[model samples]
Target: MACGALLASACAGMPDSGDVEAVKASNAGDSQVRVYAVAPRDNADPEEIVDGFLEAMTSDDPGFATARKYLTKRAAQSWKPEQSITVLTNAPHRGQADRPGDPDNEGRTFPLTGRRIAQVDVRHAYRPEVPSAFDTGIHVVQQPVGDGKTKEWRIDSLPPGLVLGEADFLRNYRAVNKYYFASDENWVVADPVYIRQRQDPVTRMDPVTQTVKALLEGPTKWLGPAVDSRFPSGTELARDVRSLAPDDQSKLRIPLNGKADRVSGVVCKGMAAQLLFTLGDLTSVRVEQVEILGSGGTSLCLLTKGQAEQEYSPVREPGRGENPYFVDDRQRLMTLEAGGRQPDKPAGVPGPFGKGTVQLGPVAVNRTEDRAAAVLDNGHELRVGSLTSDEELPEAVVTSVAPRLEDRLSAPSWDGRGDLWVADRNPVKPRLWLVPGGQGERVEVGTPWLRDGTRIESLRVSADGVRIALLVTRDDRTTLQIGRVGRGVVDGHEEITVKDLQDAAPRLESVTAVSWAGPSRLVVVGTEAGGVQQVRYVQTDGSTSATSVLPGLNGVTSVAAPYADQSAPVVADSGNDGVVRLVPGANWQPVAKGGRVPVYPG
Candidate 1:
């Protein structure tokens, strides 16, 4: 009989007591078939009873008796005696639980639990040629106990011959439910319930074949070779597909956001060679203007195209207000203030003002909106004119009153807002000053480094105004000092001197350049005895720790933060190799060449 048919019949309720007794009488008709009435005892040893049943099944002597030990009447009647005892010469050796199976073994024994043998059925094959040891098949039914109560069975018809490997058996059979049986080699089984609930395709096709067919049906066609041009264009279909895909579709909507328009530029130095760039899209543009207070005075120079234009001239006298001024783009003329002081002379001519010097400081302009900020020298700052000049000359209005800064006031580099930082070497104490913008509060930071005649050669503020790097020269050696600027006038600043850096790395000469790597990281580039050294510092716990990054540079003159997209900083060396090598991640590769000077945004 087929396995399923046999299972159906055997799984039916046990035969009636009368039928069982009749079968028992017929089997006992032979004088050799002795049977005993073994009453069920509450304290019967299940192991001992099972051993007695095994002995009865295996023994060949006709005088041997059968015991109904622990089994119910129906179960005892279902058992049958072996007809012959021909022990197979090639029977497998029984193996220990941990050891691999021996080649000549019928099966091995494992500890049976209460739930494992709750219900059992036995079948006997009476062929004389077959070995008695392998003649019987034990069908064990496992009934769940404890929290779960499901019934399952293991049918032992064929000898266990490593049919399922130990790994596979443990993965499937150890769990009451065959939860792990559904896995393939690669992925875990997907949600079986969800998969079953989905409607199956009417015409079944392999997934690969279906994908290939869809690809062959061209994107424009909804089905087969017939193009659905009336439904929607191919471009529209592609757009819809992209829209349905993950991630933002707004990034894909190109040329709709805004067009690139020239905002404004200022000519620095002589307005002939160098120019600073501002953009209509300052959000995307990475470069920022680095504000520098010239030795002369502070004046706003708008760097655009190849020229820098002085936006508004500063008022030289203290407390004297200057008339509003504007710049004409087409004629390049400077008009006097409209309501304020009119020029006593012709336009472009200095009106009571000395030869006003202009510096390429920070200049912000909105070309689309035609708004601009013209930072002026002599402490005065103005906002003037159409950032994009049309017909009338763009006018300049004083927005900020000039602070009474010391002689030779250097323009403070703006960090974000309300904070202006400047480094000065005028006095014996050359320190960094943090001035609160629009409020005129000043706080000096950094330790006193300058002795009798020492001076500060250079000072640069970080992109974020939190850190100030200064190049100082004393009697012994020129040292670099880095200090942190606090938010207010409180003196809780932290300073790191060259002496501290020497303890970190001994072989160093002078710090030539220092720039902020990121918000909290600073890159120091200087000359050492070996060559040039580049060190990166991370601020932690109100202090800075330095790590040596690049060594053996042939005298680095300047260093700047890398371009927005680039990962490495640009270092200029006097070794004449005019190449901007990009250190992407960790590897160094040359990107741009020629201009070795570092250009920092204000």
Candidate 2:
């Protein structure tokens, strides 16, 4: 089919013979700009064939049938566009191959080159890498037509998967969170993956169905070791089901194969919770309840949103209406209502730290808002104390010997599991420590990736405890990275490690601060190469959209976001303004003078 058949609006202004003018269109920074691919024309040359094929891969065409039209019969049959995807910083540049083709001159080769930035594996997991070179060759040969007289140039040998620019990838695909139970915990952990923005051609499934399929396929490799799927092995959707839609009552009915037919009601409820959470990102559809059916067409179990929330709650959802906390100029801990137009004056908590007895540098309040952990006395010592009573500061739980305050211990963070995490940036011996339940003996978490002058500048543990966000610095450049938190027993001893580190804000040249804003989203403070500092939100998968950038602020030193409520204002410590916040639909407003390290309960 021609481009007009797919998108009449895009092709409506095209010319038949005269020169064409390029006109720019904007989506106002929210919606995606759709691109319809044009099929190969008759008597096209090698360059045209390759260009058309690349463009076709970026379209929403069902089955990618048009892209195959540019390839030879054998190549088309062997090509696997679904295998993987290579994302480039920009469109690939096509040129002559460095080496000549075969001596018989049966084919010509063209090099498709670009600066590779990331790759998506067969499981639809996006892995961002340091900028690197990407070079591949497409071979075209002259083939006879049906009558065996006219010769036409067609691609005979090419790369197996698709190659797309970053812009095109964002337009054609979307990042979604698939849910799985945390190992040994009932709460669901978000494992992010990329899926087609529209229907998946290969499976003939809509976005909702595609998410269900990914969930059943299991978690991504990085998170697989830390989470578990409730679905039994070999469990899958019914063979005949292609798409999923919610009925009038906003209840979705799912049909599973026989592998799930024998599951108990409790296990089935767990499966339903996973499905409901996995399908939460499909904003276009409303699903309040989920019903699971056996392959024999019998209802196995049904779960409503309320029941799921009561039985298997999400890790980061803390209900709502939590207050924000910060350290005032007097070196005291204070609090103010979040999402308030004119909240009451910040009030000091009932503790020695709030009484200005012990100076506090950076502080983190526990999820219950009853206790606080802080780097005390010039960032050399860490302490945890209650917030409801004026208690004396306890002995330091963790201390750093780094001579300079800047090289001492970082701010402490609390996970949903009630564990405390902090990074010691000592030049001689740097380490990441986890104090179980905030009072147990501290254990040094293993991080084999920090080496050769590379050190962690700051860190934040996700509320789920399955992931940690780190601001790592090397040779004066700081980058934001997200690593998986793996816990297990080894040699009759408990072991905790952070592994599979990948860039979470690859576009930023340096990151100063970061905090988990939601289950799979974060608010970051950083600057692009040669650009001014800006605050933005980025997903755990390292994906950022145009709307991710927040309103402008000057001299931002640190940023904090509430994990439970995204509607609440984003608080930050500014160099010019002591403390500031960005409220919904408003610009930055002053919250406190000389307030530093504002934070919300993790």
lDDT of 1 by residue, 77-115 (tens): 443322212222222222222222776442323232111
- As a whole number from 0 to 100, the lDDT of residue 122 in candidate 1 is 13
lDDT of each: 0.29, 0.83
Best by lDDT: 2
Highest TM-score: which candidate?
2
CA RMSD of each candidate after superposition: 32.4, 3.4
Error of 2 at 535 (Å): 0.9
- Per-residue lDDT tens digits for candidate 2, residues 1-602, read 23443321122122333333221211112234444556666778777777777767766667878788888888889889899998888767778644445576867789988898888998899987677899888999877877989878888998768887787788668888998998989888888899988788677788888899999999988889999999999999999788899999999999999999999998999999999988877888989999999999899999998777666765434465777899998989999877566563687798777888788889999887889999986988999999998777788889999999988999899988899999999878889999998888999999998788888988888877899999999888899999999999999978999998889888788898998998899999998989999999998888778789999988888888877666778889998688888877989989897898989886
Q: What TM-score goes with each of the models? A: 0.28, 0.93
